[model samples]
Structures are given as structure tokens and as C-alpha cells.
Target chain A: MFLNETQEEVRNTTRNFVNAVIRPAAEALDREERFPSEIYEEMGKLGLFGIAVPEDLGGPGFDTLTYAVVMEELSRGYASIADQCGLVELISTLLVRHGTPEQQKMLPDVMSMKRKVAYCITEPEAGTDVSGIRTTAVKDGDGWVLNGGKIWIHNAPVADTGFVLARTDKEAGNRGMSIFIVDLHAKGVERGPKEHKMGQRASQVGALGFSEVRLGPNALLGEMNRGFHMMMSVLDKGRVGIAALAVGIGQAGLEAAVDYAGTRKQFGKQISEFQGVQWLLADMAKDIEAARLLVYSAAMKIDRGLDATRSCSMAKCFAGDMAVARTADAVQVFGGSGYIRGFEVERLYRDAKITQIYEGTNQIQRMIIARELLRKGATS
Target chain B: MKILVPVKRVVDYNVRVRVRPDGSGVDLNHVKMSMNPFDEIALEEAVRLREKGIATEIVAVSIGVPQAKDTLRTALAMGADRAILVKSGDDVSQDLEPLSVARILAKVVATEKPELVIAGKQAIDNDMNATGQMLAALLGWGQGTFASAVRIDEGSALVTREIDGGLQTIRLKLPAVVTTDLRLNEPRYVALPAIMKAKKKPLEELALADLGVDTRPHLTVVSATEPRQRQAGVKIQSVDELLSKLKNEAGVI
Candidate 1:
């Protein structure tokens, strides 16, 4: 209801594409656990990636709300596909904001999925804590040598390029970090085996190792010793994206549970006729809607240039928790069959699990929320 | 060649509509609205013709309340070069009769001077499958309704129409009318970037009086009612019992 005409139009087109192509293929993609390059090519043609990039930079140049809307719709079809879109959006946003004109040349290739990208930030020592990262990029003549490893990195198996964050100074704490544009296929870069995942398995997640990987002078993004701040600047949008994805997972589960309850019978009546089942559906619907509204409001806050830090954290925390709870309720509504594989609700329950863990755990989100509340007044 | 497509705003096909207690019409209060399914097919066909180089420009026009502009915008996003919205009424519940709609369209045709007109076979809301035929009659042009396939040759359109028994292929001269059926083609999803560009496309709005066409209702809807709920089927113990019931009760054997 808060969407404008163009936003609504974008949602309709994305929803239709998801219904026709993404949702039907989601089951096979999950079962096979392979990257669907063919689908990404079609989505690139449709300009589904880098939604907020400027029009001149070969993107749709939409606002944050529209991006959130696309994320929700795409995730509703398949979270793995939406995660790919989110990955592209972040990389493209980085390039648009920080990359030099020459480096920005990769925008079209990245957006089109011709050059797959990975945002390399998570590491073995730095899951929730960013300062503990051992990855370092040292000055070598006019260029820098990257020495680090990123674990559980999305698209590590198939990515053509990576935006790697490494420390440039050890003594400066957060100010010591710097981001670089690294060629993943270059020498001294090794890819670990693809890790089997609980959900969103279509996404190829693994480790990326870099040892003595030489970088050109133009590889440094934005400024020296500012990678942590740059990454933090994009964190709100990332949280919004993941929150929307969680909402989509919950929405898909609700739809499946509602459909199944209406058709499945018990005691000579539809299961939906039972008050207990009715309450389950009701709670699921309300929480999903509430989370959706929170996501939208957070997105709009960012779009309107407000202080959206607290709102973003709240949305991410609430949406992730809500998705986990609601999808479980959806499975409860389905009873024994929900536990079996191949059921959509079953997959959704698995898919909903990662939302609470990734994009900063729900624990970190609550900390940020509490921090903001304490820093400012409770009313603020 | 220029093709003109007339699209209607109807209740979304996904919505479960209900007749009002007053029985005047189906409830439109807070109802979801979208371009009619058949009209989407019609627009899609026109876009394809344009893409194939048979048509130079595609114009989408709608006759309804002001809110129908959304439908016309959808058409533009789907690939129409321009749009014209003729406001026929102020109330969303007021539906123009087929003849009135045809008259307004005829005026549009005379002014626009398009070489071809493609429209949906019927609107899902009212199912009055008479507008295209009436427009053809009013324009003194041949029409092909329920078109499953359309191929434009040198100076004529070869239309394969779906009939009760089989398909009938017919040829119509230039500036003909064709109404789309289900099997014509599925509409393409409007790419996100295209939707943004469509905002800059030309969309001209006109009052019904601007065309100087009489739009008095030719017919009124009587009391509307919902179809009865279907009865549940019984489970038979054996094939012999099913055969006996079919022979004795249903009498179809």
C-alpha cells in the first residue's frame, strides 16, 4: 500500500517473472544445489541487479524502497536467486560510489552477471567482529600485495571478481582496514571446495584464499585506510535487503500453509476450519505483515536520508526472528508432511534459518539497537 | 503500419469477486485492479508485431474512469509507443456498454487513422464479447475474432481463428480488427528498466465529450447473483456400484 506507481509496476513485473520462471524452478535448484546461470542471464536482461545504481551507470537507478520490494518478491520465489541479486547490488553500489572511472567500467559486466562478483568480508576470525580480520594488503612499490582469506563467502566457487577487504595498518584499529578490487582468477588466489548448506544451497559458498596477490594502483577503492567505514556505510542497505528476504521466505511459507490447510482434511472437514489452525494462520499473517512494514519503513528512512541505523537494526532483528518463528508455525500447520523433504514449507523452514544468522546475527542487531537507544534518548 | 490496442481495467484475475448484497453489481470497494487478461494478450500481440517490423508504432487507448490510466500505463510499459485515456465516467462502478465503448473507439480510430486495431475478445469482468465486432461494424471493416494466430503478409492479415469444432483461417484487408484469444501468445514481463523509461513516454488524456461521441448506456445490469456452490462427490464402493448409479440415477449410460 505504501508503494508508488513505478514501485508497484516494478513489483508486478518482478512478481510475474518470479511466478513464471523462478518459483517453478526453485525446487529443482534446491535439489540440485547448482548455480542457475541461465536464470541470472535472463534477470540481467531484465535489469534486476544493481537496482539503486544511477541510470547513467547502467542500472535501473531505483530508490531503496524499490530495491527492498524487488528483494522481497525475488526471495519469495527463491532466496538463493534474491541473494545473488543482493550480492550484485552491493558490489555495484560500491563501484558506483568509490571506484575510479576506469574501475567503474566493470559495472555493466557485473550487473549483467557476465562477471560474477563476491563481497569478501567474512573470515574465520571475523564473523561478527570485523576488527579481528587477519587479511592484510601491504604496499609493494606502486601496487599492494593482498594476503588474506575469506570464509563462507557467497559465490566463491564461480565468481569472476571479488571486492576484498584487507587491513592496510595493524595499529590503527578500525581505521587500518582498506578495500581492494581483486581478480579472483589471478595467481595466488585459491578457492576452497563448495560447502554444503542448510538452505539457499543454490548459492555456491566457500572460502577464498589470497597469498601475495599483486594489485594494480587503481585497485584501491575510495580512500586509504577507510574500508571499514565504507563497508559500514553500506551495511544498512544490506540489512534491509536481508530483512526483505526473510519476509519473502515467511510470505512463501504462509502461502503454502494456507493452501495446504484448505485442501487437507481432518475429521471430515478442512483443516483450516479448526480454530487452532486459524490462529496459526492469523499469527503468521500478522507477523509477516508487521515485518514487511518495518522493512519498508526502514528502506524509506534510508531513501529519505534519515538516521536509519536503529531502524535498520530493528527491521533486521524483528524480520529475522519473525521469519524463523512464522515459518515454524507454517510447518506446524502442515503437520507430519511438513517434515518431509520436497514440500515447499519444509524448504522454506530451512531457508528461514540462515536469515537469523547471516547479515550480522540477530544478537548483533539487538546490540546495535540497544547501543543506538542508549546513545540517544529512548524516544529518539 | 500503426496498431491501436484498446485495453480495459478489470478486477484482477487473482481476486475472488463477490456480488454485492444490493445486487447492482460485483463489489468494487477496495478491490484489486489490473489490466484484463485477454487485453494483456492483445497488447502482447501488438508489441510482437511492432518488434517484427510489421508495425511502426503501437498506440494503447482505454475508455473508463480516470483510474484506468494505470491500465494504459501498463500498456505503455508493455511496449506501446503512446497512450490515450478517454474518461467516460467518474464512478468506478459505472461500466460503459459495448456500443458506447465502440463509439468512443470509432472516434479515436477516425482521428488516429491507424492501419489496424487489436483488442481482447472479451473483458473478464462483464464478458460482453461484442465491442470488437461492434467497432468493426461501425468502421465498415472486416474483423477476425478469437484469433489464435495472426500473420501479416503484403497487404492483408492472415488470421487463424479458433472455432467450436476446428480452426478457421481468414484473410482481412488493411485497417482490419483482430481480437485475441487465450492461445495467441503470453505477454512478456515488463523489464524494470523499461517501466522507468515508460514514465517519459507520451500519454494524452481526453474527456469523452472531446470526441463528441454519445455514450448513453444501451443496457443496464439487472440483479446480479453468485453461482451456487458445487456439491461434494460421493465415493463408491465398487465399479459395479458406480455403473449402476450412472445408469439408474444419472441416466447417461
Candidate 2:
């Protein structure tokens, strides 16, 4: 109801693709824990990646709201797939906003999935605290020598390129950091084995090690030592994406629960007729709708050039918490069957947990929200 | 060759339509509307022909409220070169009869002069499968109905029609009307980039009066009602009980 005609059209197209292609394959993808290259290839052709990148850069040039809508629909099919889209969006946004024309030449390949990318931020030492990162890129003549170890890096096992965040100056603190575009296949670069996870198993997560990896003069992205601020600039949009993903997981759960309730019989009648089950379904519906509205509001604020930090944090935090709680309700509605391995609710419940942890943990979101309130005043 | 595909915006097939309590018609308030499935298949066939380089251009035409433009935009996104929207009415509940639609289409035919016209066999909303036949009759051209496959040759067109018990092959001259059936083709997904590009494509709008066709309903709906819900069935315990229930209660034994 909050969407415009174009947005509605986009949602319908995305949902159709998701329902037909992604949803059916999600179970197998999770079961096998292998990347679905075929699906990503098709999604690339459909312009599902780098949504905010301009048309001149071989992308759809859509706004934040459209990207949010796409993210929710994709996550509804499979959150791993949506996570991939989100990663591309963040990387592409960095390129569009900061990269030189020569570096930006990779936009088409990135959007088309020809060049798989990794955003290397989380480290063994730095998970939530950015200042603790020890990865450093020491300047040497026209180039730099990079030495670092990053863990829990998405796409690290298969990515062709890496946007590595490292300290260029030891004494500069946050301003000491710089983002360099590193070639994954370069010498001294190593990829750790993929990590098995409870959910979104299809996404290949591993550790990347750079042992004195050599870089050319063109490796640096934007101004040196501005990487932290540049990363912060995109965090609002990132939260919106993750928030939408959480909402999608909740929405998928609600649909499964409602359908199951209507068909599964108990006491010689459909479970949907019972008030207990009805309340579960009702709560799932309202909360999912609420989270969805919040996501849209945050997306619209970003698109309108307003300060969206608080809205983004609120959306991310509430939606993530809501997804976990409601998917649990969906599992309850499914009874014993919900706990089964193949049941969608079980997977969705597992999938909903990461939303609270990644893209700034729900706790971190709360901190940011309170920080915004205290800095700008609650009424602002 | 220039192909004309006539599409319709109907109540989404997934929706459970409810008849108005006053028996006027189906209640359309806040109902989801989408391009008719058969019409989408028809457009798909036309797009396939263009993709095969057999057709040069495709013009999708729809007769309905202004919102039908959304469906036309979908048609464009699916590969139609252009679209024409004939605004027949402002009310979403009132659907133009097949005859009026055919007359308007004939007017469009005389003006656009397409070599072929592909339309849906029937609109799911009314099941009035007469538009294609009526249009062909009005234009004095051969017609193919329930087409499962279509192929254009030098001049004539080969159409495989799904008959009552089997398939019938018919040859129709150029400038003929072919109605799509379920097995014709599956429509392709409208890609995001294509949708963006479709916004720039031409979509000309015309009022119903501009076509000089009378759209007044030729028939009146006396009443409309919902189908009766099936009664719950009893579960028989044993074979003897099943036979007894069938013989005594159902009386079908």
C-alpha cells in the first residue's frame, strides 16, 4: 500500500522470479551448502544486483526504496540470496560515490556477477569495534604492502576481488584506515576453508589472509584514511537492506504458518479455526506489516536526502527482533512438523537469527538509536 | 510483419471473487487486478515471433479503465514495441461486453492495419470467448481459435488448434485473428532493466468515443451469486460401513 506503481511493478516481478526460481531451490541450496551460481547468474541478468548504481554504469539506477523492496522479495525466497544482493549494493555504492572512473570500470562486471566481490571489514579482533582492527597497509613507494587476516568474510572463498579495510597510519586511529581493492588471486593471498553455519548455509563464508600482498598504485579507493567514514556513510542503507531482509523472513514464515494452519486439521477441524492458532497467525501478520512499514519509511527517508540514521537503526533492530520472535511462532503453529529439517519454518527461524547479528547487531542498533536520540534530542 | 496483441486486465486469478450482495456483479472493491493469463500467453507468442525475426513490430492494445495502462506497461516490458489504451470506462466493476470490444478492435484494425491479430481465447472474468471470432467476422478474415501453436509462412499462417478430442491444423490468410489457448506459450518474466526501459516506450491513449464504437452493454446481468460451498463429508470406518453409507445416505451404490 505504501509503494508507488513502479515500486509495485518491481515487487511483482521480483516476487515472481523469487517464487519460481529461488524459493524452490532454497531447500536444496541449504541442504547442499553450495553456492547457486545459476541463480545468481539469472539474477544478474535481471538487474537484481547493484540496484542503486546508475544506468550509465550498467545498473538499473533505482533508488533506496526500490532496493529495499527488491531485498525483501529476494529474502522472502532465500535470505542468502538477499545477503548477496546487499553485499553488492554496499560495494557498488562505495564505487559510485568514491572510486575513480578507471576503478569504476568494473561496475558492469560487478553488477553482472562476472566479478564476485567481498567486503572485508570484520576481523578476528574487530567485530563490532572498528578501532580494534589490526590489518595494516604500509605505504611503500607508489604502492602499499598489505598484511592482515579477516574472519567471517562473506564470499571470501570464491570472490575474485576484495575491498580490504586496513590501517594506513598507526597513530591516526579511525582516520588511519584506508580501503584498497585487492585481487584475491594475487600472490601471498590465502583463502581459508568455508565455514559451516546454522543458516544461510548457501553463502560461502571464510577467512582471508593477506601476507605482505603487493598492491599497485591504483589499489587505493577514494581519499586515503577516509575508509571508516566512507563505510559509515553506507551503513544506513545497509541497515535498511538487512531490515528488509528480516521482514522478508518474517513474511515467509507468516505465509507458511497461515497456509499450514488452514490445511492441517486438529480435533476434526482446521487449526486456523482455533483461537490459539489464530492469535499466533494474527500476531505474525501485524508485526510483519509493522516491520515492513518501518523498512519502507527508512528507505524513503534515505531516498529523500534526510538524516536516516535513527530510522534505519530502529528498522533494523525492531525487524530483526520481530523476525526471530514471529518465526518462532510460525514454528509453534507447525507443531512437530515445524521442527523437522525440511520444513521451511525451521530454516526460516534459523535464517532469522543472522539478521539480528549481522549488519550491526540488534544491540549495536539500539546503541546507535540511543546515541542519535541523545545527540539530536529524542523529539527531533 | 506487424502483429497486434489484444490484452485485458482482469481480476487476478488467485483472488477468491465474491458476488455483490445486491446481485449486481462481483465485488471489485480493493481487489487485485492483473493481466489475464491467456492474454499474457497471447502476448508471449507475439514476442516469440518478434524474437524469431518473423514480426517487425508488436502493438499491445487494451480496453479498460486507466489502470489497464499498468498491464500495457507489463506488455511492453515483455517485449511489445508499443501500446494503445482505449479508455472504455472509469468504473473498475463494469466490463465491456465482447461484442463492443470486438467492434472497437475492428476500428483499431482499420487504422493500425496489422498483418496479424492475436488475442486471448477468453477473459477469465466473463468467459466470453467471442472477441476474436467476432473481430474476424467483422473484418471478413479467416480466424483460428484455441491455437496451441502458430507459425507464419510467406503469406498464410499455420495454426494448431486444440479441438474437443484432438488437435486440428488450420491455415489462415494474413490479417487473420488467432486466439491463444493454455498450451500456446509461457510468458517470460519482466526483467527490472526491461521495465525501466519500457517506461520510455510509446504508450498512446485514446478515449472510447474516439474509436466511434458503441460500448453500451448489449446484455444485462440479471443476478450474480457465489458458488455454494461443498458440505463436509463423513469418514467411513470399514468397508461394510462405507457400502452401507453409500447405499443408504449417498444412494450412489
Candidate 3:
């Protein structure tokens, strides 16, 4: 409601699309444990893949706030669908920001809504601490050699290509790491079985393995030993997207709670009229608003080319906690029905937990916040 | 072929809309405006032709307040070679159709003699959906609306439009007007260098009177008012009560 007319129209349009297309399919995908590849394909067809891509790369040439709006609507549809959309956003952002001119030339496929890309940074051991990743990227003649592994990667089994993080220098701490654009068909590259996850089950999370994966000089993203910095910088922007996603997930929970509270009975009274339940609903609404504002503020900062790392961390930390708490509260509002597998609130409860864990755990975000505050204190 | 794509300044389509007090129009004060979505489609289609090695030159043009240059720069970022802005003040409540805009555009079209023109179907602000068709009629050119896809071939081009029910294909002669929809093509973000280059792009300025067109509103705002407010529905106690209300009072069932 705080948005302008065009944004409202876009929200309505996206919501309508979700109501018509995603809602009907949500239960079945979870029921069957099937990845929502078709949904991602549809989103790509709608040009969802290039929301962050630049105009020269065949994107719609929108701003960072535009991305926040799109991500919110998408996540509201199905967390996995929106999560897949986020992977594409992250990859396209990195490619545009750091890829070589020749690499830049290949972005039309990504922005034209013709290709799928996975982001392979998280492995089994390196979800939060990025410097702990074991994936290795070594330079050979003019080309580089990558012989490492990644796990929990979005769309690895189905992705045609991906932005992969690999270690280049064993002793260089964050500076020794590097990112590469790995074609799925390249030599020594293999995909493991799709991961079975508790929530966002429809998202294709899997492992990618490398055994002397060959890459041309063009495969290097950013500078050698700059991959960790590049990844962290990009992840800062990504935190905004994840925050938007969390808020959207919270929104879905709030809507479910509101709808049920109006009708669900308790001791011959509507649950909504019960003060205890009403307070929970009120708390959910307030939390959603706060998280949304935090996310939006960070997005605005990113748009202005300001250092938004602290804001991003704050938003991610706050929204991630809000998503989990509100979703669980939504389950409480549903009473016994919320415990069932098929209910939207229950799914949201499960889906909300990961937001706190990924893109830097809320704990890591706190550390980042404390670090920034102390740094500010020292400077001032 | 030289082509001119006229874009518009509008609120970013992802934001919610609120009607202004006095009921005359939408409140635009402090609102985040963006390049009209449909205009983006038009710009993308034209720029694609440039990328395909078919277009001789692609120029974006807009007729709005001086700040409208920002929208034109977006087109330049998307690969439009140059731009021109006709000064139309910030307080814009005029008929936003192609006829009023075509008067200004006709001057540029006549001067530039571009073989094609593209624009969005309509700005979401008012939802008139008239500009491109009206421009085609005024300029004596053919028009294609709700264009989902466009393909260029030699002197002519083929356009695929997503209609209300299904799809339709139309082959149009060159130098025509086309309006874009969401499915037309993904518009690209202009890169940093392109943004810098867009700042240097030749964005000429013209006065509304200089084009000999009277920029007057044919439709007047009779009055402005807020939408009606409805009472919140009373909560139901049980599924039985819910069913009873749906079947009886609400009569939804």
C-alpha cells in the first residue's frame, strides 16, 4: 500500500499470476517431492532471470528497488521458485559487474530469458564461512584448472551453466579464492543427486564436483584471488534480495493467518476475535512492516552506490528472524491444522528457517553489524 | 532505417497506487517514477533490430518535463544511439494519447524521417492504451498493439501480438508504429559506461509551441475523490457458520 501506482499494478499482476499459476501447484510439488523446473522455466519466459541484468545484456533496465519488488512477488508465489529466481539474479549481477568484455558478450543468453544459471558457492562444509570453502581453481597455461566441489547449490542438476567459487591460493585467506563460469558440459564436471531438503523442497539443491575442470582465461570472474571479495560484495546485494524473499514469505504466512483467524473456531468464538490470537496477528503485521522497511532501505542504498554492507546485514538478520518467528506464529494461529503437511503456514514455517541460515547466518550478520559499528566508532 | 521510439515517464510498475485527494487524478508528488514499461518494450524491440545489424540508427525521443531526459537516457543505456526531448512541463494532466504526443513527435518524425516507430501500449498511470494507435493514425502509419514478439526482415517486419484470448501475427510495412507488452522482450539495463555515454548522447530539446502544437487537455477533471471504504467482514465462529454466511448472507455459494 505504501508503493506507487505502477508498483501496485506490478504487485497485483504478480500476485494474480501467483494465485492462478503457483498456488494450485504448490501442494502437489511438495507432495510429489518434485523440483519446480517448469515453474522456473515459466518465470524465465517472463524475463525473470534478468531482473538485475543491465540493458546491454538484454535486461529490462530496472533499478535495485525494482528487483526487490520482483523478488517479493516471486517469493510470495512459491519459495523455491523465487529462490531459483534469486540464483539467476546473483549470477547475472556478478557477471555484469566483473565478467570480461568477451564474457559480457555472452550475457544475452542469460538476459534474453533463454538460459538457466546456478550459483555454486555453498558446499556442505562452507554454508556460512565462505573462506572455508574447499573448491579449488588453479591456473594452467592461459586457461585455468578447477578441481574442487560444491554442494547445496541451486539448480545444479538442471543448470546449463553456473557461477562457481573455487580456491586459487591455499595460503591467501580470502584473497586466494576465485569465481569461475563453469559450463555444465565441461570436462571433469559432474552433478550429484538432487538434495532432499525440508523446505523449499521443490528447489533443485545438489552437489557439483570438479576433477580438473578445464576453463579458458575468460572463465575467471573478477581478478585472481579476488573471488572471495567479489562473492562477499555480491552477497551483500543478495542479502537485500533474501530479505525481500523473507518478507514475502512472512506476508504469505500473515495472509494465511488472517484468513484462518476469521473463520477458524475456538470454543464457539472466532480465533481472530480472541485477544491472544489478535495480538499475534498484530505482532506479525508489525514485524513484516519493519523487515520490509529494512530491506527497502538497503535496496535504496545499493541503488545509490553507497556502502550498504551494514544495512544489508541488518536487513537479512532482522528479516530472517522475522520470517521464522512470524511463520511459526502463523502455524500457531492455525492451531492443529497448521501441523499438517499441506497447509501453507506449515510450509512457510519450514521455508522460513533457511532464510536465517543462508546468505550469511543471522549470527554472522550480527558479527558483521558489530564489526561495522566498532569500525565506525573507531573512525569517528 | 532511422527509427524513433518515444518513451514516457511513469511510476515504477511494481509500486502500489493511491488516488489523490480532490479525485482529479493519481497523486504523483514524491512518487518514484520510471520509464513507462511499454516504452521499455518499444525501446528493446528497436534496439534489438540495431543489434541484429538491420538498423541504421536508433534514436529515442520523449515529450515531457525537462527531467524526462532521465527516461530517454534509459533508452540510450539500452543502446539507442541518441535522444531528443520536447519540453512538456511537469504538471501533466493532458490527453496522453498519440494524437497530442504525435503532434510533437510528427515534427521529429518529419525531420528525421525514420522508417519505424515503437512505444509501449500505454502508461500504467492512466491506462489509456491509446498513444501508439493514435500516433499511427495521426501520422498515417500502420500500428500493431500488444506486441509479444517482433522480427525484422528487409524493408518490412513481422510482429506477433498477444491478444485478449490468443495470439495473432501481422506483417506490417516499414515506417509503422508498434506498441509493446510484457512478453515482447526483456529490456536490458544500460551499463556504467553506457550510462556515461548516454549523458553525452545528443538529447536535443524543443519547446511545445516550437512544434506548433497546442498542448491542451481535451478532457477536464470534473472532480477528485477517494474510493469507497467498506466495513471489515465480521469473523465467523465455525466452519458451519462460514458455510451459512457464504450460502445465505454473502450468497457466494
Residue-wise C-alpha lDDT for candidate 3, range A1-380, written one tens digit per residue: 55643344345446656777787787777667687767655665556666767666676566777678777877877777777767778877888889888888767676543566888888778877777889887779998888888888878887888788888899998888888888888889899998888888887788889998889878888888898888877787789989999999999999899999998887988988999999999999999999999988899899899888889999999999999999999999998999998899889999889999888889999999999988876441
- Shift of residue A132 alpha carbon in model 3, Å: 2.5
RMSD of each: 1.6, 2.3, 8.3
Write one digit per residue (lDDT tens) for candidate 1, span A1-380. Answer: 79999999899889989999999999899999999999999999999998988989888899999999999999999999999999999888888999999999999999899999999999999999999999999999999999989999999999999999999999999999999999999999999999999999899999999999999998999999999999999999999999999999999999999999999999999999999999999999999999999999999999999999999998999999999999999999999999998888889999999999998999999999999999996995
Per-residue lDDT over B102-206 for candidate 2, one digit per residue giving the tens place of the 0 to 100 score: 999999999999999999999999998999999999999999999999999989999999999999999999989999999998888888888888999999999
User: Which residue pairs come into collision in candidate 2?
Assistant: none
Tens-digit lDDT track of model 3 for B119-143: 8888877788887887788789888
* Residue-level error in angstroms, candidate 2, position B79: 1.7
What are the runs in model 2 whose C-alpha is more than 4 Å off?
B230-253
Q: What DockQ does every candidate get?
A: 0.81, 0.72, 0.05
In terms of lDDT, the poorest run of 10 residues in model 2 chain B is B209-218
Off by over 4 Å in 3: A1-13, A265-269, A378-380, B1-253
Q: Write the per-residue lDDT of candidate 2 for residues A1-380, one digit (tens) a residue.
A: 78888888899899989999999999999999989899999999899999989888878789999999999999999999999999999999999999999999999899889999999999988999988899999989899999989999999999999999999989999998999999999998999999999999999999999999999999999999999999999999999999999999999999999999999999999999999999999999999999999999999999999999999999999999999999999999999999999999999999999999998999999999999999999895
